[model samples]
Target: MGSQAPGKGAKGPRILNVNVGVLGHVDSGKTSMVAALSTKLSTAALDKHPQSKERGITLDLGFSSFSVPLPAHLQHLPYDELQFTLVDCPGHASLIRTIIGGVQIIDMMVLVVDITKGLQTQTAECLVVGEVATSNMVVALNKCDLVPAEERPKAIRKAQKRLAQTFNLTKFAGVPMVPITAKPGGGGTGTSAAPDAEGLEELQAHLVAMVPTQPRALAAAGPLLFSIDHCFPIKGQGTVLTGTVLQGAVAVGDTIELPGLKLSKQVKSMQVFKRPVTKASQGDRVGICVTQLDPSLIERGLACAPGTVPTFNGAVAAVEKIRFYAGQVPSKAKFHVSVGHTTVMASLTFFGLPDGQGVSQEAALVQMIENLGRMALTGVPMPFDKSRDYVYQGALVIGAKFDGDIHGESCRLAFYGRLVTLINPSKPAELQQLRVYKMKEKRGVIERINEDQGNAIVRGMFKKETDPAIYTGLRVVTGRGEDGVIESSFGKSGKLKVHFAKGIQQAGRSSSDNAVILRCKRYINEHDRKRLRQ
Candidate 1:
């Protein structure tokens, strides 16, 4: 496909595509910045949504492109042209899901910040998203023209210092920040004459310099996985699915599956930024035209080689709580989980190795990345191994030794993780294989002791309606460090007989503080099983 030249009517040279996400707070000129730099636009570009035009804020993702000659560093590659596809993501707090979905496809990011406003709430949120999505970033300090000529330099320096302080805690520390006025004189409405943008050329230069070093692993090697962001039927032709190619490659005649709908369609044609193309590969934003599928059935989803993507009910991941979130992340709580371009509600259960049994923090992070990479390559979950014992956590909290005070108004990014397993709830056999459990403990006073029989009647451990038979064989411990086993049910009122082989300690028998404690693990999958049955 790289060897193939452009179609007869196509204007540009053979192009190598690169996706750059344009993200920022609402009204930070993200869309205007793209418009100033882009030379071409896709069907869905530039606030095309009716609600967006009426409300004067972006509510969905927008697409546009601009082409440049291949840089000196990339001349060794195949194509002579480098096309930067601008993905303008909505910055509204409520539309964060859309921003997250857009970030997954980009190779780098251009974070736009209002120079006058410095870093707002949504701007900080975009930075957090960039930290998780991509490694390369360039900060665009926009609306520089608003400052007086005498104060411009000082204002820019002050904003830069504040941004430096903010990024000091993030991975994007030391990233380049360029002053730009995407739309000078505050002209956003279409009625006004278009104004020449300031610093756009310099911004583009920084983007081109970063392109050569950006990572594009498995760009054309893995199984075809195309993320469909827009689907619509043409008048005479078939339906067109416009999106970015996430993995592998696809040609005009290859068969593709809509895994979400359990349907397959052959690619009748392909295009990149409205230019006809014979093939498209990973990282290239292209439109695949197909037939015999209703456009309404798919708004945004994955289209891949048959049988590559699977449908599952639950998943397990190696999660780290986001430091900015102030609230606790409790287990079994439902969160809006975004995978690729789809966001769904998912119940989370957290487990880790015992205190002394766990690895170092650095080692855990490395292992987590590797686990995520494996799951990404193959759409299968890492099953919970039953042979190993794990400690269950009631809530995810930052250790006081590691946590630092943060602003009260920061975005709530609870936690992030790499998928470990994709659970199929309908299969009881599969559910039994998941070994994640919650540790339960109960304590009660020993009402009476039968020293001669080497047994004691435990009264407070079980309630009136509780059945002790289920825990008859389990072990128990006393506050004074005596070990005992549950022998059998004692009486009708939910009491049990506990036997101590070494006999109860003398101090424990007399001390009111001495109490019996029982600890056990309750598998989480059992609860899921009961929920499904109900």
Candidate 2:
């Protein structure tokens, strides 16, 4: 059954939405399986991107959904109906980042494998990425028709053995593996060219038996946090953003925040899997239209919520060492870090560990500095109260040696990280018109009015003196770490004596001619004046 009405009685299947990711190496039958399933039982399409048709490989994420029969045994459970939005992730080595993006939002995955090739390089990397996402996995031993019918049992055993050894320490231990023949043009017998309806039926039954529809705690309530994976403008519908909802729910007429873009927008419309819905909850693949915002302002890897999510350039987190990673945690080592849907370059600065040396298997707290992107924000940032039991609640994944042929046998090291204390850099002060003062002696410089100045007018919101709210004792900062504070605000010009705690330290000289000052201008703009105009 397709996605029916929300409620269900004992007679019919109850429609429960679940997102199942189809992930594997390139040419591993991920797209084929989706096409065949959609053709037979559902109404979703796969490989709609033009690049995918030209190259005959998935270059981006493709989505297709279908409904499978709920077994008689499962009918008595909480929700008898199960509808899966199959997320087909690209498997090419160059597109591994996109694969991580797909894996980031999946609840479970169907790992398709070519029975002949066993486990390729990208396949292993996909598994590692899925592990970091904490998604449940079930393997599809595809292309079974390529091997002789007599040798099918042997091929299945070999794939199972490799998986057991690879997942010795992970939660993927003893993951169920099934055999199938995903033929060309969505045809599969138990082989390459012909289609076998019975074989497909068995596979669907297995899926229904293995996966369950479960609701997550605290997902229904909280700020409506959604990540944007694709954005574009429609002819008359304004801008649309498409992605899976990571947490909470959103409805039409609700206002949301895009912190990175510094814009607030209202939800004009919402569609889930091409069916218009009044609201979308977590795990639903949705496309949302907002009120006339520029699509260019939003891109992949940005998040939307009820308000601006907390952003920081650096954080101090505890690194949980993966047993399979062969190398030690190097100091200042650059790695691509993925948090939520945002991935950026970050460096690790190790602190004291158990042996007071290189990284051991034991967990160690380290500082993570965001070296590349503008900022790193999390779905749920740490709350201000530190004494709570769960102070560190967010998750991070680090990928190293990703450049060049990442699918080589030697390059397999990507693992998850945990946060301890998130480090937020000093925020820049609001822009203001003030000049640096130069005293006769360099040691005691004070704030001074700009030269060639006239009697300033208090026109509009412009004021002659600084607001008293920003007086002395407030910490002042310029270009990171170069900090000072207002010691005295005692003049008509609101000139304050800035005392540099560490003294003015600049390049080249012990003291410099210009002292960078930080100030918060308290002028009301047009937008603010409207409220006060009444």
Checking candidate 1 for backbone clashes, the offending pairs are 381-421, 382-420
Clashing pairs in 2: 14-81
Model 2: per-residue lDDT, tens digit, 174-206?
A: 777778766633332111123552255566666
> Model 1 RMSD to the real structure?
8.9
* Candidate 1 lDDT by residue in tens digits, 1-534: 122236446655767788999999889999888888888899888888999899888888899988889898888776878889999999888777788879888889999999999899889888988887777899999999999989999999999999999998988889999999888887552312145879988999999999754347524776888877899999779899999887788888899988777789999998877888887777888888998888987778788888777765555455666667666555445555666666554455545433243674334334433222111111223243211111111111111111222333556666665566555556666666765444567787788888887788887887867655567788899888788999888778888889999999543545554688887766655744212110
**What are the runs in model 1 whose C-alpha is more than 4 Å off?**
1-12, 189-195, 212-214, 353-410, 426-428, 437-534
| TM-score per model over all chains | 0.74, 0.65
Candidate of highest lDDT: 1
RMSD of 2: 15.7
TM-score of model 1 relative to the true fold? 0.74
Error of 2 at 366 (Å): 13
